[model samples]
Target: MTYAGVNRLLHWLMAALILGLLTLGYYMTYVADYGLYHLHKSVAVVVALLLLPRLVLRWFKPWQSTVKGKGAKAVHGFHWLLLVLLVIMVVSGAAYSGFGGYGIALFDWPLLAQNIDAQQQVVAHSAALSDWGLAVHIYCAWALCFTLAIHALAALKHHFIDRDGTLIRMLVGEKGARL
Candidate 1:
């Protein structure tokens, strides 16, 4: 099966974005640098932007399956679950950052609503939303990290022990068929 070049590019690019944002988030929490916080927020905005197109592409151009076993189906199901969790993480993170009364922009272009605190009620509402969104974001990030480790190991198993093309199918466009 042929996976488009755009799909492979998006996959790797998003992987880098997620990994970078996760690291920045962890570091800035303790470092207490405004610059770091800004950087983290900036990376998150990029993640949010990439996520929209990635989700759309996933639906319109689904990845080809390389495994044929029952367990393979279960793994694919888990992958879909991971995708959902990723969206939750990205959205919650964006909401928390945007409502934290912080300024966020994509190369000087504002993405969120302006004058978010023009009304007293808006401030109160945003504060509440920020709290809950932050909590969910943190929890989901931890869960995602754990799941990512497991997923990586499983891919390695498929590549080495199982001698299958599961990992290859993701990293490359095609799986090598056995002769």
Candidate 2:
């Protein structure tokens, strides 16, 4: 497959996963059930694992050169920022949760650091870390959502007004010969 095709597939798939996980995390917090919370954490761990491989793939794959308009550059910058923030959010969240003496896992695989607390006070302290991580996670998620909205709108604009193949290159894997 072409670079654009791979990128498009990864983009949409990751978007769906992240959005679903975020929604579930938000809802799970309100419910006072340990099982539901475990489910949420499991989904988050999966997302983190998936994201790591996706990031590695992106690094190894060459990006198709797009039009170098100012708007396009800005959009690309926003995308890079979003990627970094997402990684931070995932790692911090996993660390925080694990440190709180809650070993969240998928099936039987533990995907985070093991908490070695010997006393309730240590667990309580770790819980505070979880709270801080949760706050940062929510903030990053909102920023990502806003960036996604802008990214979608920009693609629509290119498709309708610019009459360029910007959107098509990513969607259909047909890069325009000239930018």
Candidate 3:
């Protein structure tokens, strides 16, 4: 059996989105201009919206498994952990944006309000809250990168070593297909 078409579509779509978000997050943190932060926050919000429904769909619609016993359980557990980490990343990112008093824009629309101070008026800064949010966001993002590496390796192992349909099923949703 293969995954349903819609599930496969969502899976691939989210995979691309998450990868972009991770790359953007890293660049913004280390090598980018200040404006990249705004773009990063907007992308994170998009990921958050897509991920919520995807999680629910994954829980309800089971995929065909190529491995059995402990192997399958381990895969499931890792998937769950990844999802949890991503959710935390999204929440912490939002908190970081809010506590830093910066607004988030969705493409062309305004979602959160920018709180940059006027010359005469000083905005109260909550350094502690911002720091806490930044810590969580950064740590979770790093953890996600590590886990994603394992996930990709696992798929390669299934495709090249196990010679199972696990990777093929995800990629093309074709039953019993091999790499």
Candidate 4:
């Protein structure tokens, strides 16, 4: 069965946004400090917002896989784990930004930590939250990269090797596709 257009749209959009975030995130952290934190945080909030609706849609219309047998369990498990990791990333990133004395921003708009010592230097609570949140965020970032690679390779296998409609279902879902 094919996913509806909206579902597929959300899937691809999230995929692009996430991939972009991962690249931008890595560059900002390791490559150079070009002052892209605001952009990263802004886009992250957008991704977080999109995640909610995508999850709700998935709940109502779950995607079915063509793969069966023993590997199916692993595939499903990985997908679920990816979702959980996304939740963790969002929470940890927010904690690091919001509670670390830096207000969470969406293109200069305040989301959180707008007034709570945002002007002052890092406080004790901010430091603690920053420590824990940064640790989790960094770890999860690598985990996310590995999982995403696997997910992409799986999709490629389905499309190229399996030649199943799995990739098609996601790529160009039919109108009013219900299942």
* Clashes per candidate, residues 3 or more apart or on different chains: 0, 0, 0, 0
Which tens-of-lDDT digit does each residue in 1-179 have in candidate 2? Answer: 75556677877777787788767766766664556766677767677777776678767863444557785566667767768877877866765676565666785677543555665333534677877776777777777777778878977888899877777776555644244
Candidate 3 per-residue lDDT, tens place, 71-118, comes to 788878888898899899988887777776765678767787767666
Candidate 1: regions farther than 4 A off:
1-3, 113-125, 175-179
Candidate 3 residue 91 C-alpha distance from true site, Å: 0.4
**TM-score of decoy 4:** 0.87
Writing each residue's lDDT as its tens digit, candidate 4 over 16-69 gives 989999999999989777589889999999989989987787668666667689
Error of 4 at 2 (Å): 9.9
- lDDT top scorer: 4
Per-model TM against the reference: 0.81, 0.74, 0.88, 0.87
Instruction: Count steric clashes of candidate 1.
Output: 0
Order of models, best TM-score first:
3, 4, 1, 2
Please give the lDDT score at residue 156 for candidate 3. 96
User: What stretches of model 4 exceed 4 Å from their correct place?
Assistant: 1-3, 114-124, 174-179
Q: Between 2 and 4, whose lDDT is larger?
A: 4
Clashing pairs in 4: none
Worst 10 residues of 1 by lDDT: 116-125
Between candidates 2 and 3, the one scoring higher on lDDT is: 3
Each candidate's lDDT (Cα)?
A: 0.73, 0.69, 0.79, 0.81
